[model samples]
Target: MSNKLFCEGRWTEAIAQYQKLLEIQLGDADIYYNLSYCYRQLNLLDEYFQALQQAIKLYPQEGKLHFSLIIDLRRNGRIQEAILNAENAAKCLPNDYTFKILKYLTVPSIYENQEEINFYRQRFIQGLQNLIQQTYLKTKEEQQSALAGIGRLTNFYLSYQAQNDIDLQRQYAKLVHEIMAANYPQWVVSLSMPKLQPNQKIRIGYASHYLHSYSGTLWLTGWLRYCDRQNFEIYCYYTGNEPDPVTQQFQNYSDIFHHIPYNLSAVCEQIIADKLHILVFPEIGMDAQTMQMAGLRLAPLQCVAWGHPVTTGLPTIDYFLSSELMEAENAQEHYSEKLIRLPNIGVSYPKPYIPPVVKTRSDFGLEDDAVIYLCCQAPSKYLPQYDFIFAEIACRLPEAKFVFLRGTLLEPRLKRAFAAVGLNSEDYCVLLNIPERLDYLMINLLSDVYLDTFTWSGGNTTLEAIACNLPIVTCPGEFMRGRHSDSFLKMLGVTDTIAENETEYIEIAVKLGLDLAWRRTIAERMSQNHDRLFDDKACVEGLESFYKEVCSKHFSA
Candidate 1:
């Protein structure tokens, strides 16, 4: 009966039936496993985990259960437990390549110091070497079979290590290509130039799971909106994300839209059938499925934008779409693909819509007189090496409280870092989750200044803060990924807050915290030049010209 309900998509009914079966102690491993799947479908993660534990106790040798547990544990910010679980799984299933790969790939979601970052990075490299050796030893059929599961985890956190990762990226990409090509030789085969009839439009493809209500979506929306629809046929292939209004908007924009499943072969064949003249992935390296897709040579010209802002390292990827303002002169050295620097910020962004209702600091349990230093980013972006910058700013001003999201993995790491420096982070930190979209904007509006993360700068968050007229203090890094806000500020003609180094970053942050007039002056300047930042006509023109030129050149060659 439970199995019937499970197959019929009745998760809640399935859960009740499974619990009833277990009430009289008549359950087996299959019952417990089924219950766990039902609980997971309903988002009862704790319940799902307990059911998995029960199943594991009944059948200790179940490699699939071990794999699921490790994945969920890592997803829920239980990294320490996940690491232990992976190690245990590997010990039990010694011959299982999945467990071995998971064991080596598991790293902390948040780090303690630079030494910790270096340690895991080196371990990752060693693990890659081991994986390469294992792959080389496998038969082509074995390698092809391994391809389905190997992409479950990517080197996602490696990009946040504040270092150039071109070499590591290339190594991983090559391994992926070898596996993929063996499994599906048709996709890896190179295609000739697209010979489109003059009357027919150039079919351009855009694929990503984050095409709905994500920061990645926000970054690439303007490019779609400003596309020359008359000459270009946009094909949007969305994978796995639930359809929201943003998803619908993309569907509306595309000449052909495929809200496809995550099935690898099906997606690959559909894209090949479309015969895209050019394929533009707004971001890569963030999504496992997208990374796998980017490994195949499906389009005549393949390009990736800086949605994730790191080198893909895949030879299958031909170009990295970036910005002239964001990239340094030597930026070409950081990417495996040929870097195509687009004009302005590389995106003609649609400015964020300001919500009407504003909430006060007191309403949100924040002090009215305090200088709210907004550092709202994904917790991983705040590296421990830079925690002292906050401590220095707090010492300069007693009423300074840095704002971050609640229920983050970095909370304890941040608290310990401040405690090491003889300061209690709780006193100077406002860790609250503002869940509503309007409330999110309200928090940004009530803040005094925006503190941009040094190495992994904010793209949509900075743009939203600028919508609130917030003064941003940013220090650009050596790579293009760390220089987003620096470019935005420069485009808006606000230069004082663009710091050159760590010391200058602190100095600028302190000045913003200390003087109300200075903050207002900066905000006023941003407000005056706000129009220059949006509806970037030249960026669209440049992008379109690049498309035409590339198509012509590839055809001639």
Candidate 2:
């Protein structure tokens, strides 16, 4: 009965049954696991943690219990505890991929300190080499498990490296992909045309984990509202818990709004049942659940756009939504997805909430005279090139300081990265983790100049800064993160601010820093241009045309 309730998605009922079983002294590891699973399903974090802890305590030797607890702890921000549990779990199940993955998470990084970070980095490399050696020495099943374990470790390291180095991240990704393909040959595939009906209404399904309270939802709103209700139907598949006010208001516009939690196979099955002609993935590789769901070919035409600007590197994704400015013909071959160029910029937007500049230099521990070269992009977006460029800018402008808005969780790492660049911890750097969106806007307004990141461009951040009347100096690269600022800058008529290389990037930053009148003029012009770039009516028109063309092509074919 508990299993039935769980299967039917009545997680509360399932928990009640599990609790009853526990009270009768029929409690077992499986019952405890079920109770924990039910709590996770309900997103009751505390309850899930408690139940998982009890399960692990009751069955200390149970490898799966330890592994589950490790995941729970990591998700709940108890990384140090997760490391300890993972170590215990690994001792019990030496070959378990889950435990191995968790163990990698515990490995300290170079950001911890030069000595410790370097030690762990070398250890990680040695551990990976040993795992590969063991895979070659073990049975076929063991090799597969070992390869998967190595892949997880590769991903964890890649996450940390990606913040500072793009090339290293790419190299790591390539190595992991090759290893996985060698073990699981059927997992990766070269791009191929998708099989589909020649004539049908193009069914465009937008999939996102943040179909609530995020830029993805905001950009998609006008498009959904103006979709031709008769010829083309929009299906929104959401994987998040908090349904924002916009989400509630926009549901009436979509043909269907799926609020189910992320179950990749289940989501795929639902998409197949709906027989979507064109599946649009709005959120890129940010959510593992969405990525897993996307790997399944539920729709004939699967396209990716927005949310994450980077190429997903997944073979299942068919097309990438881009504009002529972002993707030239030469650049298309580099990406994993086929390039589909929209007539205008691929994304549309609504006017942003431009909060007044209320933050003073005193709030961030800075002087009013300091020329602030602020990077409003999250610490994760701070690539090594960005660090070099910003540091160079600071070096050139003695009076300029770098202010970074680090996430609460990323403050320590951000500080370490800055310190590595020879900047004093408090002399030139200030870290503010603002929880309120309005406060964030106010903070952006405080900066004299905004510096953009490469690999993953500042989408919302760039827009918000422009809305706050700040001059943003950017350089468009070959990929999504590289080109985002270019697209926005072009739309806003700020082409003069786009730089070509490191020299040019620094030159532009220095020029902006020195010329206060020019900065004020550009900021004023950008503020006026923000309306044109983020105009809801213009965006809706472009979206309607794109939808009609997609439907026409599908129907005609």
User: Model 1 lDDT vs. the true structure?
Assistant: 0.84
Over 4 Å off in model 1, which ranges? 1-23, 26-51, 61-64, 75-80, 91-97, 136-144
Q: What's the lDDT for residue 269 in model 1?
A: 84
lDDT of each: 0.84, 0.67
Question: Which tens-of-lDDT digit does each residue in 307-344 have in candidate 1?
Answer: 88999999899999999999999999999999999999
Give the clash total for candidate 2: 3
Name the candidate that leads on TM-score. 1
Rate residue 394 of model 1 by lDDT: 82
Worst 10 residues of 1 by lDDT: 136-145
> In model 2, what are the clashing residue pairs, if there are any?
164-384, 457-481, 477-482
TM-score of each: 0.91, 0.70
Clashes of each: 0, 3
